[model samples]
Target: MSSIQSPKKGTHSVGVARQYSGTAGRIENCQVGVFAAYASRWGQALIDRQLYLPKSWAGDPARRDSAQVPDEVAFATKPAMACEMIARLLDEGTPCAFVLADAVYGSDHSFRRMLEARGQAYVLAVRSNHTLRFLEDWSLVQTDPGTMIADLPAETWTPLSAGEGAKGPRLYHWARLPLKYQAGQGFSLWFLARRSLRDPGAIAYYFAYAPSDATLEDLAAAAGLRWAIEECFLRAKDDLGLDHCEARSWHGWHRHMSLVMAAAAFLARIGADQRRAAYGKQNETSPKRPAA
Candidate 1:
């Protein structure tokens, strides 16, 4: 579970300023927080993070001095940072199924391309205005929403649940539009849409690259995993002091974040063990059905 935000600041705190969309529209301040979290049926937890440093702060020695930014702190675009993390984690034998993120990473063409090249699949969120390409005579041509999945017939939409939520299974009407490109030996591209059952006019979109045999249920499951990242962020901050960093230097900030993630991971492991134990007990006490 991973997400990014500009942390709140007080007079004495050292924070990196970044733009955020809030009630005020867009605001900037001195804090950038990016994190990675682990999620599963038993529990979810934030496990890692990369603090964002703005270009302004990175290039200015004077600004760095005031903030006590470490000499090693360097500029890294959000997409690049995300790519690095994903690749490194996968390389380290992390059980990555499909990459999932909000529009920030989804809109990054290079990031999507990178994933394709690596033979990794992803179901990434995107804005309404993103373009798509159409396959024609074995060639791809730049096109509009037809390629972007806008003009689908009413019957194309299917009701599906991305995953379970706080109340129950999260349901939405889903439709998939095939893309011009085949990702690779094991990949395929498509534009996935989710419409509200009550308000069909309201729609959300995602761009997905998955295996040729991947079903809509598989893509929906990956899309639903994005929700876990948000939940991980909230629980970590509330229970594990995730945003309580007081560090003014790069090392200090990372150290604080790492410690918080460690705590969260520890708790998640304990929670998983407890759930497994309870599940075992339930099985033991339940009456067995007669053999057929």
Candidate 2:
């Protein structure tokens, strides 16, 4: 068992974001989740999930003749705030490793660059249409001319399968491009190609990077781990009622979500302990003793 120290006074941060349906009768609020990661095996710890009220929610004083409607509706711009919060957490001194995120966060170049500037490693997803130059060893092509990496041609590509059955659909095709881009200096870059799951005609592209010594296989595996974050979201929503809560006000909603995250963490710990105990018992070869 590991002893808990006073929150290990260090800077480590993880940022989370959720998209809510902007429909009629739904509260106009910005729903975003942010967390911190300490230098432990578990990389992310739930810090807060907040809802910002919109200006429309503020009640009109002239409407005193009508029913009293509450003023200040919850509204938030998730992407920008999420970046700010993540930067704040990293500024606190936490080492970065393996940032797992869904496509919403992954599609943002600014967000990814923010992590990169902090010298953090990440595995983020990108939509199929994003464009990037292929990286290739152009030394053989040019004598003394300085060759730009982004203008190089793609030499190879690989398909990533992520659908139902063996023949369901192709999720994306990715290739390692050996070109140099200013944004990815000191790191290697790969081009990711994704097609629409439903309509096979649509396609997208993105660039992924890692330290120069990193291999293509390693980058793919790291990106694959992003699925774990999806599982976490499923557990939170399905088991912990992240989206079904009845809280209407911004403050109430934030407070409830925070509690739910805490409960989920506790339950996960309990489940881990039980699984470990069961595994240990099964591995033991000793015969069961008879009761006296």
Candidate 3:
């Protein structure tokens, strides 16, 4: 989810309020939109979006009517909007490998439960001080992530590259610890931690639910995929004028966002096709060795 900051704080535009804007890295007069993106090895593009209606606007009938908010549209949390989008994706049989999200969604119990109830695998970031539970010597032990990681031995940390970035491989020391509670018979929960090699104190926490056989590397990779959504937001805003909406009505904002997402999907398809063509050409030009 991301927010588009508005130039003026006037009470005209729909969903515009003084709120947290990730783009600005601070609270500003903006409209927040919860978006769902489909990402894979081939390409990534936004598939769904929901404009957040704050309680103030939802309770005000005058504002609702002025902004043309539908009668069925009610106030919903960002995580709830995300869950609805994901449910639609799954119902439509959209191919998905793993769900990835940041602390905003990860810290919500209902949001996490919704994903687990559907038997979906996910790796979600959480706060360093987030509470955690695990089994030790046939006993359930409760602790926060920071305390748990601090108690681990140095040998437990495994250095690995999460994925390639603009600079090079995004290297970090990662570790995973099994949780006591299971999502289901075959599913497992884990507490995953990552720390930067340059600054060990720069650490992040994640909670993952996946198959029991899932490796630390798999969880790390899933965690890294969260960047895909951010990249989508970046490309859409910079290239497609995603945040340039001047609409005051709710329907107007939705219409603009929908059109922008369509354009982004089209661009992503073209990029993927070009990449495949280049790969095929390289293979065709290379000499093949004779089989023995």
Candidate 4:
């Protein structure tokens, strides 16, 4: 997770610093921030989802040189770019249970297509205005959309429960729709009734993809897994001070942020080791007194 911030007061003036300007003295006024995160999730014992900080957020207008920074590379905002990132990681043999993301990444159709193409499964949160179709037999209909293609029949949908106990109520309604957007291609469309957990009655639409055999229960579980990303963001911001660094230069900002991520990783490792030691001690002490 990454965030960009500009000066609150006024725009920065562009000029060349006297010390560095030997041949041509020109400094471009711009906004700047750090894109700090680990590239892989191995140390955390979680899925192989890396924390990518895209360059566009740092006030790079053209987003051309974003990927040039090897430590903190730029990512394409397009859905296909997201797909490419995942594909590269998977190709490198990163193991993961499922892909999870928020609505911003989830809404990208191309990204979804790429995930499916790789035989990868995901549970993503979508916005309230997404489109969907229901599963149904379309062979007998006069308009056959072709193989893997079917149309959802109009029907009244039902509200479904989201999340388990103590996490607060994140409820939604869903319908498993059949869709055929292109010729000779079709897939199951999961339509979800969108409503904020804070406001129960408010309704909207969200979409998802799954195999024909995917059950309602499976979809619900997949959607819930998206919360893991939320947990990641919270830890990054609150625990690691993700948005509080005060570096002015591009390189300086990233270097500082990388330190923070390294610290967090170190702490996580220490905590795990401590837990194992405590458990080992407990096992050693618990049953010995009875025999004596």
By TM-score, the best candidate is: 3
Please identify model 1 stretches exceeding 4 Å from their true place: 9-15, 21-25, 135-147, 280-288
Q: Between candidates 2 and 4, which one is better according to TM-score? A: 2
- Give the winner by lDDT: 3
Clashing pairs in 4: 128-205, 133-177, 133-178, 134-177, 134-178, 135-177, 135-178, 148-186
Local error of candidate 3 at residue 227 (angstroms):
0.3
Ranking by lDDT: 3, 1, 2, 4
Quote the positional error of residue 203 for candidate 1 in Å.
1.6
lDDT of 1: 0.76
Each model's lDDT comes to 0.76, 0.48, 0.86, 0.47
lDDT of candidate 3 over 1-292, digit per residue (tens):
3334444468789988888877678888888888888888777999888889989898999999999999999998888888888889999999877888888888888888988999999888889877766678989887898998999999999998888799998999999988777577689999899999999999999889999988899988888878988899889989999988889999899999999999999999999888877764536558886789
Q: Quote the RMSD, in angstroms, for model 2.
A: 11.7
Report the lDDT tens digits of candidate 4 across residue range 97-123: 556555556777777777777666565
Clashes of each: 7, 30, 0, 8
Model 2 agreement with the true structure over 37-100: per-residue lDDT tens digits: 2222232234444343223332334332132223432233444455766777678765555554
Summarize candidate 1's per-residue lDDT along 1-292 as a digit string, tens digits. Answer: 2455545554323446656733235675646666666567788777567877778678988877776777887888778778888877878877777888888789888889988998988898887777665678889777554345556777888889988877998899988877767569977898888888888768878888998899988887888888888877777778977667777776787888888778878888999999887874536569887789
Q: How far is candidate 4 from the true structure (C-alpha RMSD, Å)?
A: 10.4
Evaluated against the true structure, the overall lDDT of model 4 is 0.47
Could you tell me the lDDT of residue 265 within candidate 2?
76
TM-score of each: 0.88, 0.57, 0.92, 0.55
